[model samples]
Target chain A: MIILGVDPGLTRCGVGVVEAGASRRLSFIHVDVVRSDPHESQDLRLLKIYRGLCTKLDEFIPDAVSIERVFAQANRNTVLGTAQAAGVAMLAAAQRGIPVALHTPTEAKLAITGNGQAQKIQVERMVTRILNLNTMPTPADAADALALAICHALRPSGALQGGEREQHLTQAQRQWAEATRKANRGGNMLHRGM
Target chain B: MIILGVDPGLTRCGVGVVEAGASRRLSFIHVDVVRSDPHESQDLRLLKIYRGLCTKLDEFIPDAVSIERVFAQANRNTVLGTAQAAGVAMLAAAQRGIPVALHTPTEAKLAITGNGQAQKIQVERMVTRILNLNTMPTPADAADALALAICHALRPSGALQGGEREQHLTQAQRQWAEATRKANRGGNMLHRGM
Candidate 1:
């Protein structure tokens, strides 16, 4: 299956698309950073990122998308930015009907280096070794994205199975659904004018 | 100044835009929830959110945006979704040349109710009392958004100052600036052939 991987950020997102099959072979489809102008409004910048991401999604047409799960304790702004990036990546995958999977950084490291605490360099080395690349992945973000994808590839399918995690209902959606269900159940009563 | 507040989430985001003056009087400009369809791809849902936010930014023309910060936790998927929503909000503000601010949930509660440990309902009541809304804000998300705005208003000027608390680069602009500075310094050093 074609797997798309993403390392999300507000201004810069690293994306990598790889083709994988029975032989454990990987062919790089794409890798790049999506950015926005600093002087622009936050809304416009967000739009730019969205558009850029959509373009990437369209181009890759991957069977699955994998993203790194951020688990960091930092400043409020930093955390906010990271969240936004992750949201965009998730949204992109959801829009295209592609199955999406998430990998923790630690899991990715462990999968690659047999150590959850492996450093960036170690992970990079393992990625290069596993993928058999002549040169290391340019930009750490791209490497991280690849690692996330690799982690997903190694995960149990059931572990990545999808359905609504929480009940799939907005407050309004829930209210409407409940009302409709009630109406359906009470149809005989309504017909009898009771 | 006009301040937009956002309570980011994976499924639904509560957004509030309010104008606050030096006298602390507040005017509600708009309030709503940005939602995504679960049946759709996550990426597309995020794009919808990004576009919706952009439209709001255009309509309100806020001077700054305030968003809730996500904390590091074991819930990897939740954290990822929250981060993406936060990123969309930040990009929206930044693109508009509006500065963005972030506050922890406790900081916002403390600012609104003088009690960091205040419950959600308690914070909502305080927000209603503080803003003198005609009625309690419809959904808790909207109330939380207003609370974030209030927190930003209560903060001292430049209270949400931009700087890397741990390193030196938090936002893209800051990172670019740092890179430029280093480049210029390196150029000067190169002129001396060192």
Candidate 2:
């Protein structure tokens, strides 16, 4: 299975693609940060982001899309732009009949570094180690996107053979997966079951 | 010239179209509220709103599109959904090569009721009066949409002949128009100069 992850923002939308094997091994396929001019009008900036995501969607054709889910209490200044970017990302995925899942920032961090409150460097280090890459992805947003994809792939419910993966999963991983599953069941995650 | 106004929201997206003559006479063309099921996923809801706006854009081929400009300090619970819906609305307009403008609630209310803090009923009444409609438009969102279109049409820069319209413009109208013009110039209104 292939998954596309997005760390959505108007100024810099980070996207990464990862391929997952039946054995649960993951391989990085692509990564990039789509950017729009800050001086441009909001509509045009949104258009650029939407078109860029559409192009990536068409190119990768990932089975699922994972995006960072922000809450209402997020930063007052940048939350609006972040939500708008995530909106377009979800729309882009849904337009092509791809299911989209929103994972909270904490969820991605916990999945990567075994600590929900992990620092940026720790998360990046873990993502690099998990993906088995020699060099870390440049910019924090790109690394964050890869972490989202990995989180989605390793989630308990998202695993191909749930029973086998459950036995090998760590205590932190199990707890995170269970929490995510409950969130999805409670309709808080905003997953599109396409 | 025709203008399509949108009061964007996820559950109920209000849309109105109006024709503006060179003499500044406004005529109502069409009005409807595009709705999406609340039980649907966010992606599907956004997709529905985008497709609905695109249909209106293609049907009317409006010269310009006007949307309610919401601020960051708005209601926290609904602000995210509103911004997302507005994002898709702007995208729909931009995708069709139509210029888009964002007018604040104060601007629309002041243009129609001569008061920025006008009540909903008062704004609705004034919209009916301005459009010369026999029956008031149903739903507050629909009325707000028409008011936005009228606001955009009467703005100082949007008028066909600024000098001619200036003679009959009220002090409130002139002030509102001036504010909008300045906001556009300041890069605060997010007007797409298509």
Candidate 3:
């Protein structure tokens, strides 16, 4: 199963594509940041972001699109722009009739680094190690996008609305779930197999 | 000049089209509320609103699009959806290369009723009088939209970015400005003519 993850922002939107193989092994397909000029008018900026996402959607054609859920409680200045960016991402996915899922930042962190409150560097490191990339995904937004894709790919069948949910854990997924349990023994952070 | 005004919302988006003639005379072209099912997914709802706005932009072929500017300081529960709706409105207009202008509710109220804090009914009454309409625009949203259009039409040349700005105030605009000054003697709430 292939998944497209979006870390939405007005000035810089991060996108990552990932594919899941048997036993839940993951491979990276693509990653990039969609940037728009901050000096441009709001309408023009939104149009650029929307068009960029539409192009990505057409090129990747992923099975599911995952976006980081933004909250109003975030920074008052950036929340509006963030929400607008996410809206365009959802619109792009919906235009193509692709299923879109929203995952919180915490969920992405927990799935990646086995710590809901993991620092950005930690999450980045885990994403690098999990995907076996020689170089880290530069910029925190890019790493966050990959984490969202990984989180959605590893989610249990019941947690998802109507998408593919692997029944068995691949060796790599098992190791990650074990790592999560090892990191938080008292907490119930186990994946489905565990 | 023809102007399309949008009072954006997730469930019920209000739209109004107005034409500006010589002497700043305003004629109502059309007004309606575009609604989406709340139970539907966010993406689909946004798509419906986007498509609805696109249709209006195409049908009316307005020279300018005016939208009520939403603030993040507004209702927490509805602010996100409202921003998303506004985003779609801007997107639709930008896609067609239509100039878009944002008017705050306070600005609309001041322009329509000479009172920034004017109540809904007062603004509605003033809108009816300004347009010489036999009936009041039903639903506060619809009236608010018309007020936005009127505000854009009556705006001074200096205030607008690149759209046509009338050098002289129409008779109706003069009366409205006079009324505004009369309503608040101590306030400098004058339109360009005053």
Candidate by candidate, in order, the iRMS in Å equals 16.6, 6.2, 10.2
Off by over 4 Å in 2: A158-169, A178-194, B158-169, B177-194
What tens digits encode model 3's per-residue C-alpha lDDT throughout A60-95? 999999998776667666777888899999899998
Worst 10 residues of 1 chain B by lDDT: B185-194
Q: Per-residue lDDT for B8 in model 1?
A: 83
lDDT of 1 by residue, B17-130 (tens): 878976778777778888877555556767787778888889888888988765444244455466567777776677667888756676676667766677889998888887
lDDT, candidate 1, A44-100, per-residue tens: 656677778789889878888887654434333445455556766676677677877
TM per candidate: 0.59, 0.90, 0.84
What docking grade does candidate 1 earn? incorrect
| Predicted model with the maximum TM-score | 2
* Best-first order by lDDT: 2, 3, 1
Each candidate structure's count of clashing pairs: 31, 0, 1
Interface RMSD of 3: 10.2
lDDT of 2 at B50: 92
- The true-versus-predicted C-alpha distance at residue A22 of model 1, in Å, is 9.3
